[model samples]
Target: LQVGCPGFGYAEDMPSALQNAARTSYARKLVDEATQATIEEWQKQNGKLALHKAVEDDKWKRDATKVGLLIDAERDALTRTDVGFRLPVHLAARGHASVEVVALLLEFYPDGAEEKTWHGYLPVHLAARGQASEEVVALLLECFPEGAKAMCKDGNLPIHLAAMYEASAEVVALLYEACPDAMAKLDAGQAEYVEKKRKQGAAGAQAARESVRALLDKLEARETRDRRIEPETLPQTEEETSETVAEAA
Candidate 1:
């Protein structure tokens, strides 16, 4: 696994030698003999390829330019999953990577949002878990709205995971907005999973969960109000009222 991987947070202190290996690979096209030699040197130096490091670097730094350069220089790494249970896009979204980096990965692999990790968390799920910016969540939703409703292997919906794991109210709000119906449709496992999170007493957990609950209340109230509005209950103009009276008469 990459040392400064997303979940581990070690990428910030990644080895200088590793960074140099990647820089050497990035300076030339993959097909060049010098590039291959450099790659061989990198392998002997670190036993991993520069492309993977570049992808990981993009995730940690949120640099779309580096990501684009790496992708252009190492297209095969586009779909390659790192040893650390993530694709390049997964790492990007999970690391709260910039929207440009996230968008670039999506453009290259539109289905990445749905690609599940070994733990059954997709990119969107990780984005929520990572407390990613609202824009990142929206970008994932734009590509795969169904991902908003995706369940982890353990049976927790994305919103449930977000409310429980993520502390950002905005991130929770974005997930809630994406799947309002899920809020009302929780089964036993879902409720239990969330209740456990609420009990954790983590900083921002209570507020984030409550914010989702408040939104659900508002949505439910709106739904009830809409359901109660029959044609007869709707406001009538004076002429319509008079017509109704005349018909009754």
Candidate 2:
């Protein structure tokens, strides 16, 4: 006759009452049947609970601050590139109140220190393209003494870009103030070419010369106006002055 305990012997050799109680306890621990309804209720509220937790932890505030700083840094760096030079130009053109940024760049990187091209355009080219306000244009011209004559690849001058875009009279006038010699050079070259064509009896040569003369007239008028308007010097703001000093260090 065999007598068995739960761990010491097989179930077939165990007392029936002890085996039944062991199985009942194992099932209760494994299944947890009492909490099934409560678990369903918690699942329904999970999304709202997660949102409240995130808010309490200030996760959104931290994320926004980080993202905003990153965007501002990226924009600042892009504004410093020569090829992406359009960025600051457009900013100044629109009078975005970021004139200080433009002033800082022009003052610090007059000839575009790290630019790759042989005739890498100075900041003046960008100002011309954007048709910046007279104040902005004058500020750039001050930094680049010969701002109007600054050339790019293939000898394209600032005036050429400005004329192509049909910028305001004020922009053209500003260029004349900075570099009258450049305008005169272009005009003289055009006139001589037109005269040669006329002497050769080229067809439509007279008409072409008339058009050239008209452009010269406009250029001369702008130069006159530019002389009449006093040039104002723009001082670098405090923030820009500090940044420039730090860069020098």
Candidate 3:
């Protein structure tokens, strides 16, 4: 009707409500894009910012909510089924605790049922490579008891990894505490073999061999003592009687 201004239909004279709505939409889009770019930049900067920023956003508490949403939405596009195994490992290597992630996998995936990379590492291997801390190692050991002994494609165990990378001494100590055999395995015959191989020119290697030999001797003594006990605690068995009978016979 004539009550309404005829100029209202013109592009310049569009309703004030529509103009305000368009501006707000544009502003919101810009803010969203900026927020996304910030997040990506933070992630690229070694995860520290992401870890801290995670606390600020409700959707990022456990596993970034946006990532989780994207994964869910595009799960069909994922070609591989091993993301469950890969994600936790990546997180661990990146120095994120993700304890809950490890626990969830262990609880859901049966022992030895998990898929692995070409190198045969379980999530524990990733954790070992990540921080090499006592707490992280302990958690991995708890989830996969034998994970400490798991071998990489190069035949290096978790202990080997720790040694090669010079990881935390405390972590190496913790792993040795859990499985003393690992030390023996690492030093097994390596000292004598190296000594035999070096004829004359390599003094440094020879010294390393000697040091290793001394270490092995101490380890052997400790292991022997640890395995030995008072006879009172020994279990009675037919083999004990058979030995006694053989001596008397």
Clashing pairs in 2: none
Report the lDDT tens digits of candidate 2 across residue range 1-249: 011111122223332444334433443454345443333343355432321121113232123222222222232432342233433333333332233333333322233312323345555565566555444555555444555666777576766655655544555655654555665556555434323422343323233334434433443353343324222333578998899899999
lDDT of 3 by residue, 1-249 (tens): 011111112233222444334433443454466655655665666242343333223444344333332222232222223334343333433344343333222221223212355676655565555543354455455435566666767776766555555545555554555555666666645423322322231443234334434433443353344334467655558998799889999
Question: Per-residue alpha-carbon lDDT of model 1 for 1-249, expressed as tens digits?
Answer: 112111111233322443434444544543467645644554455333444454445333365555555565555666777676677788777776776677666654565777888888888888877777666776676567788788889887777767667445566555666676776766676555544543453335335444434433443353344334346545689999899899999
TM-score of each: 0.55, 0.37, 0.40
Deviation from native of the Cα of residue 8 in model 1, angstroms:
32
Which candidate number has the best TM-score? 1
Evaluate residue 208 in candidate 1 and report its C-alpha lDDT on the 0 to 100 scale: 43
Give the distance in Å from residue 197's predicted Cα in candidate 1 to where it truly belongs. 15
Please give the range of 10 consecutive residues that has the lowest summed lDDT in model 2: 1-10
Model 2 segments beyond 4 Å from truth?
A: 1-97, 106-119, 187-249
Return the lDDT, model 2, position 101.
39
Candidate numbers, best TM-score first, in rank order = 1, 3, 2
